[model samples]
Target: MKLESHQFIRYFEPEQAAQISQIAIIKKFNPREIIFEEGDDSDSLFLVLEGEVEVSKRSGEGNNYVVITSVKSNGYLGELGIIDRKPRSARVVTSQQTVLAKIYYESITEILANTKGDIVLQILSFLSQRLRTVTTDYVNQLAYKEKMTLIGEMVNTIIHDFRSPFTGIQLSSSMLKELYPDQESQEWCDLISMQVQRMLNMAEEVLAFSQGDTTLYCQLIDIAKLLQNFAKLNQVYIDFASVELIVSVEEGLIINADENKINRALQNLLSNAVEALDQSEGKIEIRARRKDQLVEITFSDNGPGIPQEIQDKLFEAFVSYGKQGGIGLGTAIVKTIIDAHDGKIFFESSPSTGTTFYLHFPIAKID
Candidate 1:
């Protein structure tokens, strides 16, 4: 884009615009290049001629920068430097190959000295608009932080309240196992105890996630065994739902992961599948295999697929479709757990067919 065609340049008379254009120095930058750093001596006003730039401010943590906004073609950056000689308050980086017209502080002052138009007011108006936008963003961020803090506190309180009952259940299940030494009875008692432990873990998981942490207690686990145990744990629900769950897991596949969290993630998928089936006769299939150096697992169900409107944001918090009384944190929690394990998750769905969620994890190194 030409400097003459710029809207900012049009704010001045033709003669003044020509004078400003004479002083403007065009510069080009490659993608991912830093144009300026926070705290650098502010000198020039950058008018974007091509591509885009990212504006970011140093985070409170001081180790990283949080992106505040993006300036695309025809937009302008560093307008504040034209008004004052203060240091740059934010960092600017090229989002892609970019071209910018740089007008130095001195050049702007010289142009203002010769200008007859209301150029000073035009610059001030730009600064005022930007300040308003930034202020609104800052306020919204504070409100979000406060809201999340309240949720964290509530989750911690609920977890504490549930701990005692979970303990009682665990003790009862242990006593049952001791009293009934028969294989079948002992199996039921063991399932009960395992379930009590899972409930406690689930409560803690919610608390930890609300506090923005997903601490993994990683261990080498047999993939086949994990899938088998998961199927067993949910056998009652599966039977009740009248769903045929087929598990096709390859043996000798191991992964380094948090067993409880992985189980919770799988349980969430199974729960959603059963709900999709609406207690009707349907099929749920889980398959696992070694794909290169990673273990690929798929959970699929032949129910009405995810709603088309929400497919793009399925993993985002508070996104739900065709569910009653769902707060929509299940898939969000699942993504967080998988990310903590350095794994990947994606899915395919069709209204005519069903939904299939794929999870991939690196194989655990055995020495």
Candidate 2:
């Protein structure tokens, strides 16, 4: 049968339409035949003249069918290659005896050039509709993934925060049991109370984290003093890794910022640096200075650097290096805090020299 009047006029002008019809040839395939395979470099559009085809991919033990859009007498397929210049994403197989009008890219382009006015508008409109549909689908997928990630983070924070209170409860309950010798009932009651308090603390932390109330108030923070405090606090981790924490900052270097957030960011960097050292003797240099009204802080560690492939996405949520038991949210949280403060954070690293995280905060301008 001839190309439908509406389909022909929709894609090309009368003259070009006739030319395309003359040049196009109908190709037939048997059942289970390969019409096109994923990654094939064939930029051709196929208008089904008869039968059906299935687009799918092989996964695990079975074939996963993604799209089963039919291509009946006047329907089409293979337009993705023409638009994106990419290979097919799935294999198109002849589910049954199939016939299609194969129009190569050259012919399509020739027809498009010759076509004018509403004919061009129609073709473009069709392409635009298809593009919008695909874009919407992709955005929805990303949104779904983001929702799942947030849920996972909430669960993890609950578990992490619970550990502290749980440990405290365990210790307290054990002490109570030792004090109440032969009073088994009282000891069990103490244990239950401790466990309940532990759960309450865990619930509170989860609620706070989920509510996004982790950021504290802004104040004038002394960078040098903060580093000293952090060093003392994390001395155990530093010593366990045989790492030396060296701090260098201009005396009296004060910045107007959220002290808690900055401290958290610094802590994250230090933690990452220590982990990167892999329990080896390493040197971590924390330096801060005021450069042109910007407070620049640098965390440099002498350990194995990040790989090139993962560097670009280092600050993205849930992206972890080779460290076991590492939650990749630290850098992501640091970036989030910096961005909220209108500051910037970047890093540079190499295999032998290790990595350095550079954070810059604009000094509060005074009248």
Candidate 3:
């Protein structure tokens, strides 16, 4: 019964199992490559020879794939499908570079017809245990989602209620800045005004993101068009300054998201990039492309890059570096907006290489 590493063949004659290996096809898959999808015709049963796979199942009622379990090296897939000659029951996607030994249904049937009854019982037992594991995973995932939803609602309520006080403070600081006549006192008022405005922005961003699905007006928005417009609108600024801006989004690349929110998040990033290069001339490149089932957008800057002081807390609210009158909420807000869309945001930067931020959003599911 110890099946790991093709050792299960002890149940049958070694010569027979070894003969089957000759006809067994070995296939390789790269990271994120889908081996098969649910409902696809199943012609073969696969045995993972190396690496790992994320096994998920899709129900007819839902548009998303619910993770069932992970199958590692030596695990078999589509056994039930092979036995019944039915469609694939689940999807198998590679978590990394992987190799699989595929035995066609024709080969399996031929071997089974000649094998003893115990062989069939062994296969049935393997599948039965796998079914139990998948059932448990689905139940646990549903419970986890429910708990997360409740926590999200509580956070949203708290953040939304904070907006009023932040707004009042923002207004009071603005009035104080105007009323103070002395240069030093006026500067202090300006600092308070800036901080208040930053907090207000943070509160608004948190509130907006916390609203979850309702906050996003999902539509098939063109990614290229958005970046083009962004560059066109900021053309004057780039032209007047001693800096260069490059936009390189592929035409027709689109995603499902809230257009206004995405545009705002990106604008804030660009503005921050420009302001960071205020003293020294720099270049910023915006690039986008299709990466698997997501569109990956990169914003790169050839300035001094993120300073060591604020690099760690760059995405945290209220963390700023040498920039005068900085709120440090821009990147934080950007992250919040992306997270609300079920997208991702990460960056890499150093003094020599500058900085680059990557944003990835799932492709729109066509109904």
Candidate 4:
């Protein structure tokens, strides 16, 4: 059966449904508003007419909340309270501006007396389905957590083993800088030293990620300088592939971010684009502009767009699709790095138009 605009209307005749609608008060909630909290008295059942809400439960220590599920349009909440007359079991907050039908306990009693439909049975079915979903999510989370823990330990061991060799490289680079004392030679030595440190930082980043954490060393970075350095580093590969790299940036634009991490993110995007082009007549464009209080950066490529199979889960770990030698963690790490900087990252792609990634960062304030 086709669903009516009001889900409750499907349970009763037109006249009764009209009465139910009249009795149910329409309520509006703003983003992040708390409709109810865990342990609160439940006097009404909320049926969502628009937008979304997050349902969460207090952690075992009661210090934080863990999101259980999100309820969107045409879904209902507080059904367990209506059926069992118990206090609310979860906290519900609006994820965006929302409209809900608030059906109070007194109104529910009136509907029960008149309606012949199996409303209670429907509520039971909904609850049963929700339970199964929660159980499955819990199991998956547990397994993934265990896997990450193992990865973290392995990463730590590898970093420890590499510590002596990294120290040797650092010492050798510093010695070369001192011995040469010439402009170009010193620059090369400095570059080698910086890259050696960046390698250690990258290893630590992976370890942190495995432990479900992000650590950043943020500094003011010149956007144009960063783009120039990126192009210089990849010039050899770009020339070999016969690809054109165009960079445009607003003068004096600056961003407060972890420079190494952001550079790594750009590298990942470039890698994907290069592999997609497969050394053909490809063009990649990098641009940065200031918008309000944010700095927006775009990386676009004229190549075959991303495959449809992995578009939805592009930012998820291990979601590589239609790529050769892709371990699938690039975009996922990029998202984590951007999120850690309190920035935003997204992409658009199509078969005819190719792919473009957008990154937005909070513009750094200078004294």
Estimate every model's Cα lDDT from 0 to 1.
Answer: 0.86, 0.72, 0.75, 0.82
Clash pairs detected, candidate 4: none
Worst 10 residues of 3 by lDDT: 1-10
lDDT for each residue of candidate 3 in 3-77, tens digit (9 for 90 to 100): 334633444567668767777888889988999988889998888888899988774476666667788876778
Model 1 lDDT per residue over 1-367, tens place: 9999887788788998998899899989999899999999889889999999998888677657666778888888887777778999889999889999999998887877777656767766867887788767666655545666676798788878888987888898888888889999999988988888887787778767766787888999999999999999899988988999999999899999999999989988888888888566699999999999999999998889999889999997667765788867789889999989989999999977798999999999999
Backbone clashes, each candidate = 0, 0, 0, 0
Candidate 2 local lDDT, 167-244, one digit each (tens): 777777677777777777674756466445535543443344334445557887778898787676667667877888
Residue 111 in candidate 2, Cα distance off native in Å: 17
> What local lDDT score does residue 96 receive in model 2, on the 0 to 100 scale?
81
Ten-residue region with minimum lDDT total, candidate 4: 1-10
Question: Which 10 consecutive positions of candidate 1 have the poorest summed lDDT?
Answer: 139-148
Top model number, TM-score: 4
**Every model's TM-score:** 0.72, 0.53, 0.50, 0.80
Candidate 2 vs 3: which has more TM-score: 2
Better of 1 and 3 by lDDT: 1
On the 0 to 100 scale, the lDDT of residue 315 in model 2 is: 86
- Superposed on all Cα atoms, model 2 deviates from the true structure by an RMSD in Å of 16.5
- Which has the greatest lDDT? 1
Candidate 3 shows a clash count of 0
